[model samples]
Target: MSAKTIVVGNFKGGVGKTKVAVMASWELAHEMNKKVLLIDMDPQANATTLIARSAGITEIESSIFESFENSDLSKSVLNVKENLDLIPAAVSFKNLPKFLYGKFSDDIDQVSYLKTLLEPLKKNYDYIFIDVPPTISDYSDNAMMAADYVLIILQAQELSLEGAETYISYLQFMIDEYNAYIQVAGVLPVLLRPGGRVDHATVERAKELFGEDNVFENYIKHLERLKAWDITGITYKDHHDNRAHQIFIEVVQEMLDKIEHFEGGEVNGE
Candidate 1:
């Protein structure tokens, strides 16, 4: 089965991009029993740290950079759980741009290198989720080039909204310039506060800008448990943890629905 590769990102930092990517991958693998692979494209390695904690790994032996350098990502795969796997990132991944330029003469080859490398492994999983840094760089370019869909994270602020818009614009640029076959999955809102004035106004503005249907109905409310997961490594120890997990489960279900709709030839933002 060919996996549906999705890149979760935003052009603004602190918009919960890595959190959404990690939790969504966790829910899909741990909760729904799906074979999932999470590829951390961010050099910060936040996703790597959390998943490593979950797997009880104190030190990273390998990273995606090694896979890229070796031209075989399978060699770097680390099993996080029963159905979950991860290709961790390293700070050394910042050298990717230089490596790409040194390896390929054409810009297309540079941008699409990750896609070429990932194609062979697509048949091994149900889904492949990529978490990239919040910027327009080699990391994001490679991730976008390799993905079938991009899930934009909107954190319910004016700057975040602008970042989402800029991200969509860049996605379109990728499609038009390099012929990357990808689509915007949908905008998932991460609220600063549930029912707060800024949160309400931001979401309304997002719906108007991105179209009502293009914005997810189920949003992520600010939760202490989510913050705790950064340190505790995604535990489900209490009622609050279950509640937070349930919220992502709903979001993921909706994401699947949107993907199905897109596959059926439904136009986005319609």
Candidate 2:
């Protein structure tokens, strides 16, 4: 079966986009026993760092940049867990735009190159999650063109909400301009606090803007364990770690349910 590619993104930074991408992939692979591939398209490579730390790898010999240069992403695939693989990103990936411009004269070809490269590898995994930078750039364009769906992260803030709106508008632009076949899977809220006033109001505004049905019910709560994982890598040595991981499990279940609904031919708002 071909993998369903999903890009986790936001137009604003510091919104936990990587957290959702990494944790969701981890949950899908470790908890649900699905074969998952996470492509770190962001040049910052935070996803690559975290996953590498989790896998106990201190050095990366090759990265997605090498794969892009070779036009073979499968060669860069690194096993991160039992069912999870990764195409690590490097600082060198910042040259992707120059690389694309050198290769293709057509704008569409430049943007959709990742789609062509990913087609051969799609059949090997159940799901492929991409983590992109928080901006409108070649990285995000390639990811959106390659993806089947986008999971927009809505952090509880005015700017974050605006970023999500901008993200949807850009997605529509991609659809209209390049005819990219991708859908908005859902808007997932990552709250600053469990029941903070700003958090609650931001979510309400998101529901009003994106429609209630398109917003996910399983919002991510503020968890300190998540921060710890960034430094120490993902852990399940104690109840706190499991509790933190459980949050993503619930989120993934809802995400999969939404995906199934979309696959069943039900429109998101209807």
Candidate 3:
């Protein structure tokens, strides 16, 4: 089977999107032994910085911008691990919207550009993850269009929950108008506290809005160790006893299950 492209996104920032992307890549590469390429589509480049730091890469000589300029994904790909690779994003991607405006024919073709650029690399990896920016822009559009499934991440905050609904509505709109290939992998809740009242309430409300099955049974508890790992360039394998690491392993398992069983948006009349 071809690689399954999953975009980790939410219209709300500070929702731990990068953390989840980084953890998922680690789990897929080291645990599941999957060849994974993580594309950092966020101009903030948190995922890029995290992976680069972990790989001891101090200078970023090439990046995703090169792919946009030359349609050569190879130019930007960094082999960070035995099975993990990354297409690092730069702050320069802030200019992508203006660049895309003049490059593609119309809105439809503009969003479709990423799929064309990454098509040649599809067979090289078992999974590809796109880490998108928080807002609706050419970057997120391209990621969504290029993806087979989107994994929406949100914290159990009021604004985050509201933004999740808005983001899903936007996805539905995209499916109706431009891409019918994408469906939601699941809505993952990152709880600041595992059993906090706010977290419980938010999960229940999310089930009410998106359906219980649409949300994953497992939730990632907020762990301070994760932040330290990000800063220290420590992989979960090295931090073997950390509960956050175990939680991510469960999350990865759930992702694999969902992807395996996903009927496709087109098949489900989405």
Candidate 4:
């Protein structure tokens, strides 16, 4: 089966991009029992640390920097458990762009070189989930072109809303001008507004601006369990009974159903 490569990205940071990427990868691997590959393209390496212990400052060999520069990345990958593999990250990833900038001076496709390198691994896993940085860097561009579906997570707050608009406009331009095959899954509205409110007014505004059908039907509430992983190294599968973990399981199922829907005209319908 051709696995669906999904990317979790946002132009604005602190919207839980790493959280969703880690949780989704675990859910797909453990709950769905599908082989999952987690690629950390973020220099912060938050997702890598959360998934694998002691990241951010650690010198991980299987990181994107080494692999992107023609290092033996395949050997750096670690088996997280049954059906889950991880390409960890290091602080060195911050310099990947400068390292690769001079390699292909005239090639427009050079930005997507990482994705092309990873394409061969499509046969090695059932699902590939990428955690991209919160900026429009070369890493983000690589993830965008490589992904079969892109999920943009955002909050309803003023700053995040503005970010959504700006991000949509820019990526839309890129889709029109560069990658036409890139498919935007939806804007996942993470209801981080305090007091557990959705601000239906804002939701309606977004739907009016970007299409009602394109908006995700479900929203992840602001839960303490969602942030509990910050101090802990356990991922969703490791803390299977936690509320946030279960929610992640549900969210991954939702994404898988969407993938099935797009591939053929059917959802899991369960």
Q: For each candidate, what is the lDDT?
A: 0.88, 0.90, 0.82, 0.73
RMSD of each: 3.3, 3.1, 3.6, 3.4
lDDT of 1 at 142: 94
Candidate 3, residues 75-193, lDDT tens digits: the string is 89899988999999998888888888888778898888898889999888888999988898888889989999889886764534876887899999889989558888898988655
Most accurate candidate by lDDT: 2
Q: Which candidate gets the maximum TM-score versus the true structure?
A: 2
lDDT per residue, candidate 1, 1-270, as tens digits?
A: 788999997898888899899999999998887889999999999999988886788877899999999999998898888989999999999999999999999999999999999999988888899999988998999999999999988877454478888898898899999999988899998865545434677788888888888899888888878888888888878899999999999999899899988788532223
lDDT (Cα, 0-100) at 56 in candidate 3: 87
Q: What 10-residue stretch in candidate 1 is worst by lDDT?
A: 191-200
TM-score of each: 0.94, 0.94, 0.91, 0.88
Deviation in angstroms for 251 in model 3? Answer: 0.5
lDDT of 3: 0.82
Per-residue lDDT value at 122 in model 1: 89
Worst 10 residues of 2 by lDDT: 191-200
Give the distance in Å from residue 41's predicted Cα in candidate 2 to where it truly belongs. 0.3
Pairs in clash, predicted candidate 2: none
Candidate 4: where is the Cα deviation over 4 Å? Answer: 54-59, 157-160, 235-241, 265-270
By TM-score, is 1 or 3 better? 1
Error of 3 at 23 (Å): 0.8
lDDT of 2 by residue, 82-149 (tens): 99999999999999999999999999999998999999999889999999999999999999999999
